[model samples]
Target chain A: MKFSATTALAGSLALVLGFAAPAFADIKIGATISETGPASFLGDPEAKTLKMLVEEINAAGGVNGEKLELVVYDDGGDPNKARTFATRLVEDDEVVAVIGGTTTGTSMAIIPVLGDAEVPFISLAGAVEIIDPVKPFVFKTPHTDRMACAKIFEDMKKNGITKIGLISGSDGFGASMHKQCLAIIGEYGIEVLADETYGPTDADMTPQLTNIKGKDGIQAVLNPGFGQGPAIVTRNYAQLAVGLPLYQSHGVASDGFIELAGAQAAEGVKLPGTALLVAGLLPENDPQRAVVVAYKEAYEKATGKPVSTFGGYAHDALRILVDAIKRAGSAEPSAIRDAIEGTSGLVGTTGTVTMSATDHLGLDLSAFRMLKIEDGGWKIVE
Target chain B: MIMRLSSKATTLLILAAVIAIAPFFFPSSYYFRVGSLIFVNGLAVTGLVILIGYAGQISLGHAGFAGIGAYACALAPIHLGLHPALAAILGALLSAAIAFLVGRPILRLKGYYLAVASLGFGILVSMVLSNEAQLTGGPDGMAVPELGLRAVLKAVGIDLSNTEFWYAFSGLALVLGAWLALNLYHSPTGRALRALHGSEVAARTVGVDVAHYKLVAFVISAIYASVSGSLLALQNKFITPDVAGFMHSIEMVTMAVLGGAGSVLGAILGAAILTTLPQVLTVFQEYEQLMLGLVMMLVMIFMREGLLPSVAHRIRGRGE
Candidate 1:
């Protein structure tokens, strides 16, 4: 059981040599995902979708005759890893564009890296800050927290719900959505009767829900956060029998949320989600329906897992980048960046995407569709 | 390897050799980023070494100081109009003051009580950072103003790439920090701290001013963590409350213990191993955490004193 420094050093030496960047290919796209951490629910699918999409695109005679290659690294939800991998994707892999960042923090971590390198980075995480200040080389496919808030509020107004209670996790995603939801609540003339917060790892949210339920004149409850927190809140809310409309952020838009919260607990819950969730429910007239249906089918077939909104984000990012590459007629980073910014009316899994010099994330509030959980399935609410 | 060199000389040599040869081995900027990360973590853990190694005081919330240091860089330029460098100093002073104030009362408690108190301190700082949306940018985290030190260096005809600059800059900081710590180890104050660490009652009877020495160690370690945090924020140009989170504090302590918290070089070696291990394990993806746990467990079980100390002991012909 003696410690051997030489053996340990050799092991690490082999690790470094083994992972030395492989040969570069034409039309390279790189991605960093949280494939095995707190955000792995999002990253696992994101990695799969990127791998599957690249294979499909290359199989279809590549993008304009140049084979598309993907270089992916799992960031494990660590900002440091995201920064390092992002820099490597540009400097070592020499990718034309990068897509990834499964969490708001990791996505934001890569902003300065990609901005300084002047390479296009399409973030899959939700956060207005990712693109609000509008870093030149950064973009995202998912609707921002602001857009999610607006969509949920509009739905709330339609349902004649004005007074509501809010509970959010104290983590990065939850706190950001809480702020956005609060900022726009006044616009919809909705009054937040009770605003409560819970820690990300809190085992029970019943105290917060109980306080909200005790509040007078509260017609609905909104919880904004990703992972187990939202599921915990949903369970607690249903257990308390808080006879109010329950709303969630797009963060918990995946089927995993329902499974975690239990179908009975999640029933009648409304949230803003990407079109991919209820792709089968969309009518033929919807432009995104076909794209969603195709992506979901291919993703489920490729990975043998149910499609998640996170993967759709990556899928939309790749399609957007490929469209820009086609329009720019070059695989150069600068050209691809400009072409991506100038992108207009490209059909995507999320919705029809339009890019401009100012708006890095091209999707509008329309990108988010109001979905309700009914009978253990997502039903699009028209 | 077992040649008669002083530990200080050994530490300096290792630091110099790593700083000099790491760049040659770097395949790209990626390794530089990882290298900078190691130095940053090493810098923080070096501070912990002074407290845990010399003073025998355990802190489970030192990363809170790092959080303070990081947000100082992020917010000071915008709010106070202070330069980033000055902001880092401000952060260090602030961390020192807070640690001193908190240490005064909590340091009286022994073992688990002190650990709990420090853990609470860290949670409180992170909670404030996460809750104070207007100032700390809530949890989405605010952008840090560029330190622009590399640009300044470039103007002086010492142009280095971004990754290269961070790697060298952080490496220099770690070297400086380690130099100070090593010098302190031989000083009268360090002797007093170690006396208290061995037995506070015995040191008190010997007129060692037990509480004062412990506070000094705590404050000094807090400053070290703060400076490290500031460096990380400046390099990454991003700051999150997670820098001060419970897990980060655990990582800092784990790095110190894993390397041999008792020695400056050992602490740094621990930081390097843990930081590099995760990066290298990225290739394994799914098995990353499993392997990391296994390595940590194996090391703790076999090399009880940690990687460097145990290996050094063996090399020096010590008992198995």
Candidate 2:
């Protein structure tokens, strides 16, 4: 035991020295992700994707002839730890740019640290506040809850569903989406007939589903939630036979949701999801098809895990940062920030992202493809 | 009496020296942030030492008070138009009052009963903080207003960086917190609490007023936790519901017990170890949790009494 302990210590000392060795002009990119906690479902893939992408990039003669050095710290879904890691990334590692904030809380905690340091940060979390009243140095990759709502409402309008019943989880993602949907339901000429919510740990959402189902003249039902809450709601919705076309938010745009909700119950459910979810279904002429397919294939091949929309967010973030570095022709923080802001027509797994001075999240409602679950698989709804 | 006085001064002196001199050894400003976090945690653990180590009481929900304190800084500055400093005081007072009320009934229960009741209290606070989205920003958390003390210092020509200011401020708070706790160790109230801890029945027979002493310890600890929470919120400039979650309460107790809950210096050492361990262990990447768990298990197994106390015991044994 003592021998192994000494060996481990020596190994770590060597690793530290390797890291501390004078860089050969490598462009350092730091990330703080919740790789092993409550938010690990989102972050585990993100960390993997970042590692795989950096290795692939380095192997392909690196970015701008400089190797991309990646520094990642697992925040374990703790905001305090996230803040500390953000500080370390900015002050200690002195990274040119940062990516990865796996949850809204962690992203919010990191924003101030990165903003103060003037380091260009690309967050993976899906919160509107991260960009709204935007900080000069902060950006995000995931489509916001507001955009998800807008996409869902647009689809509902195309289907001629005027009035809908709303069921949402009281958790962060669910509550935020619920509020965003309510705010813009008027814009799409949709009115919510019944609105209900379930707690994060609520075993059965039957009571809430029943309340929504009881509402008259409701053309469809929209359940906006993440985790098992949505799965439970879907199960209850199927059991109740609400009959209206059921729509879910982009929160559960994974195969895991279908397995949890059962194939039959989730069969006809439609949700706003990224191109990565339906990469195989895209047309040959589509701009994002190549990008999404390449990412999906590479990610699955490397990790032996199915590609997720969450991982795609990190993929887009890293791609955008690299593209920005290439365009900037420099590794300076401010130059990178400006170059990121001026990003245009950069095809990524998410979409053909075109960031501007005013917009940090370049993806629009079009970036989300309306996908319906059919035969226990994702089918793109044209 | 002189020995006791010098011992108290010695602990304070050592803590102050560590806080002041540690900065010189820091490779970067990140260490300052980590150091400040350790001090904030140390303040809270010192309170737990009083409650669990001296008073022989356990609380698994002290983070509830911390959440109250943190949210107070976030909300009061905006809603009530109070200064951030005053908001911190209000948070501490509110925690003390709530602890007084909640401790009365729950402190009557012994052992696991007290722990469970306190755990429920913490869960209830976090639930309120999370559920009240409009007021508290829900689980996404809310940004806290600046404490403005740095600005005050700047006006007086003392311009430290944000991390440096927080390090000095929180370190000072920890020193004050430790001084008070060490003083309490030798006070009349401390003896009553310790007497009850040894044997409540015997203490009652000897006129210790067991209930009053327990309540006193609980309130004091709650205040300590509240102050610690305020410092965290002010330094981060953002507050989340997780600050008041069950995990945070467990972390506070763990830090106290893992250091030597019996001594002020020992508890601080525990806080330092836990805080720095996570930061240092991040280099292990995916193996971070495994490494953290292994380190903790090894420490508990080897030391048994905690890092500082066990080391001190070894040194004394060698001397003998």
Candidate 3:
């Protein structure tokens, strides 16, 4: 029972690396992001917001007499790299819980490894399948492709969109949106006039758009969740003068779409996401008001720029994981996972986050807000 | 016995033996996790050794075969009512068929032309896997049906954990794959293919049936890649387009070169080292790509024969 100095040192290192560095003398949570990939546009801000939130939590006297140490790994949207980082965080860093992988593909790759280890993970990637066949400790912070389809279709229905054409990336995000489009378009009394597809690295969508536009009587266009796919689609829609109510999946932010598509092309295009995008349009008493205000102030101070809801989810994911650690009162993975699942009425920038065993998604279908580009930015549809 | 190995093979044998035994002393299940990954990757690289080393043809899209094998497990049971194991076989068949077709046309091309053709083929496959949502579940990825091999084995009193099963299974697969490939290396067909690799026109003039041997090599290597892919997907219980991406294909090739592609065991050694090094190097996160690029450049340029071959040659010089 006489512990040697080596044994004591090893144990201390295990503790420090087991749940993370204890600089905060409190619970520490970790996030792995793609800070330098094609998806860094999403991952960099996410990392920044994580810092802002951790700082805010520490300033408010820390969590339950402990401070927040937010450890982050840049996945760069690679699956192999993500798995290695997950191990380093789980074994070397010993962080209580981990969050953030920019793309669903990378998120799905690490899900089993994280699950087998019982570490809680939250992803910001816009894929519902990330939560399906669910890992016990995994949760996602975005609306699903299916959910986005249903919401967009409902709005399309309300706006009398009956004849619609669909264009999607031939990638996973594109395929899901295509399926969702096929399923929801029918219910909204919408006919699929034309369906076209393009590759992920494709910089031009003109050929596919020409095919769709060549067909007669297509009244509305649904460009499913993608990056360059929407940019190409919107620009083509303008050049072709389709004049249709072109809707994009929530994955496409208004800023990029407008910048890529030109102002006239993006003038009436719609994208769906959590209300954090158009916080100014929500009622004063909206649940997101305080979160938006607080996050905006923090983000500007931290990064010296405007913040988007993508960053909001990244912040929320870290906060929720930390909150679970606090409630569990221990760094045990199973304990933290249960604490996260049972959390209810936890206010986040997106909405009230409440996850249960059956549903790992926090925000509901009602949480999606429809916004369009008016002058230069998103305008909440009146 | 050591002198009989040729200094290069002697060094590779030592390195391989060391890696095979090293994980036993791993302080935690974490190293086993990485060990199993190396085994999986080495299994694929072993297949590449037959193609790249023995046959002298290149496949920049072998990962596409891995995707087929992976999605076979993912899509088969859900759509076709097949078992995961059966799906793996079916995927292997699909890969062989595709390789046969793709090889027939582009195997005729040599050097950079063949490399670029294979690279294009790989990118196209990844795009299809990511884009075709209904069948393959595109970029979000689909969960693979668990292999249940371990579960079935356990039911018959063969109990194993996730890490242990993959570790032993992938290791066994590598050995078997290497043994088969080694057997082929000594076979008449293997000799004929190597003859063609040495000089295609000379082999053709000498009646080696260069095209036939090349096609056979392509299909056989494709099957190896497919089975490796199936094992990887089964091990993880998931599959994504990244498995079939051009980058993974290149990684497999680099691994083959790293171990001295001429030796199957050496290829596995290369795969094991590359797979495990990143785990240890995670502390140097920012320098990852830079380090990988540098290691690859230095190894290929200075150590043209590979880590094992060059080290073995240097040690032999000391004796002289």
Candidate 4:
């Protein structure tokens, strides 16, 4: 036993030395994405996008003469692990910027860690609070849930729909969007006739949709959540034939949702999504068309999978950081943070990002494009 | 027969040696993060050692206590103007009280029935934490105030980095928790609880108060989970309802059972393995859950009594 213990100790020392040797100075960026767990649908693409972009940047003469080194860790959708990895990235990896917290919970978990470490974190998640009480070192590329609510409501108003029913998930993303939807319903002159919620793992949301269907004067149904919940809701809505038009949040902006819900069930469902989803269909005169098209083409060609807004978040985050790093002319975390905050009118895959002292998200309602699922593909509605 | 130290002394000695020596193998502060994670989990598993190991009671929802403890650290300081440390204490107290109140009625059920009841309680707690957006931040989670112990240490000329500080702090907490648990194992109450674990009817016939002892174990374990949760929230400076979610509760149980729920050392061993294994598996990324499930299945199949006990049994081999 003693002999084995000594041998194990010696082996660990050798391993540590092996890791310590030949550390080159590279422009290191870190990411904690939910690559293999519940949020993997968001993270797998985001990780691939980040990896592809880092390679492309390095291949294209690096980030201003320094090779981009991305240190990616799969957080498994756990906040605790996200916090740990965030700390590791800042203190151990010494990364100047981080760019992928694949879920709202994981994103929020790392906010203080990166804020204190003074490393700039560009979150890919869409929770409004991630940037609401803006931490100086934190920014995100995705439009907030509040913005999604606004965009959906604006579209509903244009369609002469005023009375709506809400069915949100009981998870963090769902609850946050639900709150925002409630808070802003009055502003949109929309009455919430039925407000119901289901668990994240609920196999059926027909009961809730059934409740919404029974509500008098309900012009539409709005279900706000990511992952399997919205898909299940869509399937059940179609199964139950609720007949009311279903509006989903930007949470289900991915093609995965359409596939999961089945084409017929997901048909005609409207959502607010980033331009990445409709890059192929965008007109030549659109401001975001070029960048969106570039990212979508590069990403799809590299991964052989369709472009997703989740990946767009990572793409936009890295691009924003590179832009900031070029302007700042230093790899220092503090300088990168300030440069990122000072960003103005930088077109990203998501939208025109304009960061300031108070607004770290740098996205307005225009960042969202009203999209509908047509023939199992996304189509621009307006 | 070979002479051996008392179980309590052996457990403490092992814990001290492991905590003191493990840092030598740590490659970076990243390892410290993994270490602190293991200790926090170890602390919670140690609490389960009392309820599940000694009393032979199962709690599938102890993470509910952990959630309460974590949210307390996040909310109390913000709402009531208390220091973060004091809020942790308050969270622990609240967890203990809730455990006692809930345990009284639920402890009467046994086996799968008890499991279902505890599971319901956990689900309800997570639901409230998620649904009550006004207080709990409605799923985006709320930030915990800093504990400020590092500042105090800095003033005293004992500066330590955040990762280093949490690693030491949580390690010390685990040691303290293990010591208390070890001491309890030697107490007469411990004997009564163990007796009830052996056979509740037989224990009742022998004049042991089964309900009272079960409640005591439940409350004690709940306090353990609460403290562990507080430590986690204070360290990460964030709290989510997932802390109290059914998954976390299942993780606590799995850690205890996988290590040897009957032994404090075993429980800690279980926590250490489960906590560290995931961090190591983060490299593989895609194979994490598959690998974890395979490891768990192999352990259960080969070593029915858990890792430590089964390994120790093999070493002792036909002795005793």
Reference-based TM-score of each model: 0.87, 0.95, 0.85, 0.85
lDDT of 1 by residue, B124-198 (tens): 999899789878877667789989888999899999988899999999999999999998988899999999888
> For model 2, what fraction of the real interface contacts is kept?
0.57
Fraction of native contacts in model 4? Answer: 0.54
Chain A TM-score across all models, in listed order: 0.88, 0.93, 0.86, 0.86
Clash pairs detected, candidate 1: none
* Reference-based lDDT, residue A49, model 2: 97
RMSD of each: 4.5, 3.0, 4.9, 4.5
* Cα shift from native, residue B206, model 1 (Å): 3.3
Give lDDT per model, in order. Answer: 0.86, 0.90, 0.77, 0.86
A1-382: candidate 4 lDDT, tens digit per residue: 1322343346435534543222366788899999877788789999999889978888787766878777788887889889888877887667889987888889989988787777889999877678878788889888877788899999999999999999998777787788888888899899888889999899988778888898899999999897799999999999998888899988878777888999999999999988877887898999999998988888889989888777888888998999999999989999999999999999988889999999998888889899999998988988
Against the true structure, candidate 4 reaches a TM-score of 0.85
| Model 3, C-alpha of B36: deviation from truth (Å) | 1.0
User: Between prediction 1 and prediction 3, which has the larger TM-score?
Assistant: 1
Q: What lDDT tens digits, residue by residue, belong to model 1 across residues A23-123? A: 33458888999988778878999999998998888878777778887778888787867888898788776788999988888988898888888999999
lDDT for each residue of candidate 3 in A172-267, tens digit (9 for 90 to 100): 567667876687666668788898888778877878878887888887778875777778778877888766678888877646667887887788
Off by over 4 Å in 2: A1-23, A201-214, B298-302
Candidate 4: misplaced stretches above 4 Å?
A: A1-23, A152-175, A181-249, A252-271, A371-382, B1-7, B21-27, B109-112, B313-320
- Which lDDT tens digits does candidate 2 get at residues B138-227? 888999999999999999999999999999999999999999999999999999999998999999999997888999999999999999
Interface RMSD of 1: 6.0
**DockQ by candidate, in order:** 0.39, 0.49, 0.26, 0.39
